[model samples]
Target: MLELLLIACLASPVGMVIEEPPKHEAAKVEHPKPEKKRPSVAVPEEPPTAKEKAAPVPKSTPKPKPAPPAIDTKRLAEAEARAKRLTSENAKLQEALARKELPTGGEIRNPAEALAELREGNRRFVEGHRIRSLLASQDPDLRQTLTKGQAPFAVIVTCSDSRLMDNYIFDQELGRLFTIREAGNCPDTQGVASVEYAVEHLGSKVVVVLGHTACGAIKAVAEANGKPLPGNLWSFQAAMSGLLETTHEDPNETAAEHLRHLERNNAVRQAQVVLDRSEIVRHLVSIGKVKVLPAVYDLATGQVLFLELPKPAKAGESAHH
Candidate 1:
């Protein structure tokens, strides 16, 4: 019976074991029941196990940015080729012009050297150390040489003032300077055409637009003050169209001083007019084959003050706007 009772107790879900109480306790005490062992079953692990999840992963780096575009090589090559072609064409054109003109002997070819020659000649004139003009002995030789073909190094556009003689002022001999005289030194279309002929055909290296201190035409135009002059003289006012407007009379200056200022401005304006009117002269100047300068001749001192040239047009620009 005791054996059967033990078997029944083991079979019970609550497997408890009873124990006698200690002498200090009055009631009986029951021990805790033991848990039954569960059957073992396989459990599928998730993609990342605890070990895999705990491990650190490397971070992904970003990509770098691209560089900027370069200039087109094809366009650069075309531009260089075009420049070389133009230069060759210009050289050929100059050769043709020189052959057509039949330049005389002892004429200056370089533009800078020609300008220096003029300056030196003027220095001699001012100092009264005249050499070329005093060589009366060379007159026959000079006349004969000029008969071959004239190649004046400098073209002088001056007033018809009786007192002023370009050959004497610059101390240049015959065939050295090509002079074009007008009442006011203001060039008309014909005057500009003459300049073109001189530069293009005669191979003149420098163009001098010379004005004097006491100019009758300038004085007349200034006195006219927009009022038209009588007869053909009115052409003078038209030729120097904007002289008075361009130059203002200073309150501190006398009438003579103001007239002198107008003369200077007129000289510069006429020089620019030549460039404006003649594309041939402009081209020669742009190529550095020729130079156009404005000069003021002092009647009192017989000195010529060459003014600065006007600002040049930009490349591909025909004239200043």
Candidate 2:
């Protein structure tokens, strides 16, 4: 009976279902569904407030520009024309000056040439080659020609000594030198006026204050020693007021030497006096239109020594000294 029971247990019952245990099936691999995209819609901005709309927008300020300079065409043209004319005249003058030739009729227009002519004439006179002036005096037509008009080139302020003849000393003919004579060669007011006339009207280019060696007038003044001279000659002391102070007598030098010094100083002083008293002379000298020089003439040698001129005074200076 036990054997039959075992065999029946081993045998499968007919129409019995045998179901397998539920497998894990990889957790069913659950894939998530794709997310759907929604259509986009733009949101409108908020409208400006009434106060902001009514307010004005600030603008940048532009810088102001300067105006252009005005041009005067007529004045510009006149200036250009004047410059050209002056340039042309200057070129012509330079050409004339370079040649060193005297113009027609042996006339000198400028101061340098006038001074040179005087020097050459003096040289001729000293060297005994003075021939032109001799013939000039003899010429009949020369005097008549001079009568028409005179254009003296030099004005001579010289002593009235009998031996000191400026025409013979410089070998200049008539109308060539306008001469003024005083006892001491010191120019007074009238003498200065004569110089003004010569320079301004006659166009004389050189004014020479000429002194000389062995001058009697200088000796008289020196010997007088501030004492009033006898007769009308006392005016000479007044004219030569500061001469003694300017030229102190040297103990080592002879009395004659001191007189010579006084003579030369007087010449220089007179030249300065002319410049101080006469504005016309000062202006011409300053502009180079004329020259005022002091010269010493040797009575024995007949030679002229031109002294160095003093420097011009500054403007507004009342006196030259």
Candidate 3:
């Protein structure tokens, strides 16, 4: 029985006795390990070529030019024509002046024609007739023509007396007469040269030595009566005295009559002196190119009494006419 109980106890759940593990002897577990990594490096670039380094260039623009001005052909032609016309007019005027045409239209060609002109003019003067030539001298055109040159018809050697009007008495204008005046109408050296120039160069036709009835010079010399005159008048007195000595005196003639005779004789004597002193005058007179005469002007009567008249040159003589 005991054995049977023992067997049952061992087989029963609670009746068995088990052994336990010690506290100090526990269980151990293992884990996996971490991995290590390496660092990264940078790379360098290559240089550029010549063709990739150059840049492109830009182009420039040009400007336009201006046009020329227009010409006026019609105006230029008109101006040229006007200039030509003015030049032609000036030439014509110069040619007319060269021909010696008087503006009054009277022409003097020769000495004879000049003498005839003077005679006709004197006649007209005495008759109080007015001719166109004398009246036209006041015209400006005629005066301008006279300025070009002078052609006197006659030359008169007369006294310086205020009463003697050569222009009025002869009916002459500014250029018609060449007159030489002195106290006694005497031709000294200078006066002779002037007469010669007129005859030789100016073509004077006639020369007259005119004395008056009551000439103061003749009276003064007569009163001197062989005595020397005062100052430079002695030269004139000597000349008059020489002329008087040669003059014939009537014994019964009154003093006034003698003086008048001397006056007339002095006129004739001075006229002769002109002929003797100037060879040019003598030659002209001989050839009938010019005539020299002696005359006395009666102050009271206004009449000219010619003491001597010039005869015409002989035939075959060298007369210019």
Candidate 4:
């Protein structure tokens, strides 16, 4: 029993020590992902050969480009409206200026307006043009126009003395005044007719009988027509005796005084002749249609002693008229 026990113990130990074989593993597939690589080569930037360069494109007539869209109707309408408004506004402004009653250097349309303008200008000249700057330019257009026609604004009937020049006395422009120069500024029949034309046709408003100092014409009348005044003036001496006789009687008066008295008297006489001789001028004067001013222009003072008259007032009121 002991021997059997020993054998059984050995056998049981041997059986307990026995182990199952390990499972076999799959075969290693060490393909290394086939190394998954292609041959690495550098590429050239150029074509493979110069002869293989791209061929030039053939020249062609290009298709017409698409047109831009038509302009908007609203934009066109707005532009037209703006243009019309501007044009209407311009016309309105022109109309307003036309109707305005201002002396815009236009023609003096009436006798009364002409007189008023002369008086107004004289007033401004006597005072000063301190009001505002004048906008009038010396028109070059006048230069071209005056070359074509004679438009004398005034007619000066004055003495034929060296001391009296019409442009100097009145500060007038060339062709601005028509002058009929004579001794004593007296009206013969010729002078009478000339004055009528100046007033009636040339639109001359005034017949300026401008007289001056140291008159030879009056001296011939004063010295009793004895010394023989120069140049076809003796006939006038007979006509002017009444005026000259007044000067001679004043013995107290100086030679200068004699001349001044003569100057004034001659202007007065001529003014009378204008009314007596020219019926048209006389009618024009009487109706307040035109003015006839008898003026004695002083050589020393450059001032005019004027008589505004319906002229030919008698010698009795010579100082007043």
Candidate 1 Cα outliers beyond 4 Å, as residue runs: 1-107, 313-321
Summarize candidate 4's per-residue lDDT along 68-141 as a digit string, tens digits.
Answer: 44666664564345334333433442343456522122244445554454444334333432111111121343
- TM-score quality measure for candidate 1: 0.65
Cα lDDT tens digits, model 3, 72-181, are: 55644543343343334334434556675542213555556665666665555565542323433134554676777666667888888888777766666677788999
The whole-model lDDT of each prediction reads 0.72, 0.72, 0.63, 0.55
**Candidate 2 off by > 4 Å:** 1-106, 136-138, 316-321
- Reference-based TM-score of each model: 0.65, 0.65, 0.59, 0.53
Best by lDDT: 1
RMSD (Cα, Å) of model 3: 58.5
Judge candidate 2 against the unseen true structure and give its global Cα lDDT, from 0 to 1: 0.72
Which pairs, if any, clash in model 4?
none
Query: Candidate 1 lDDT, tens digit per residue, 1-321?
Result: 222222222222112222332333322123334333333335444333555556575565643444434646665454444334333433443454456543231447777878888887788689765545554534664475457688888999999999889988987777778889998898889999999998999889999999999899999988888888999999998888877887877899999889989999999888888888889998999899999989999988888999976576564332222
lDDT of 3 at 32: 20
Each candidate's number of clashing pairs is 0, 0, 0, 0
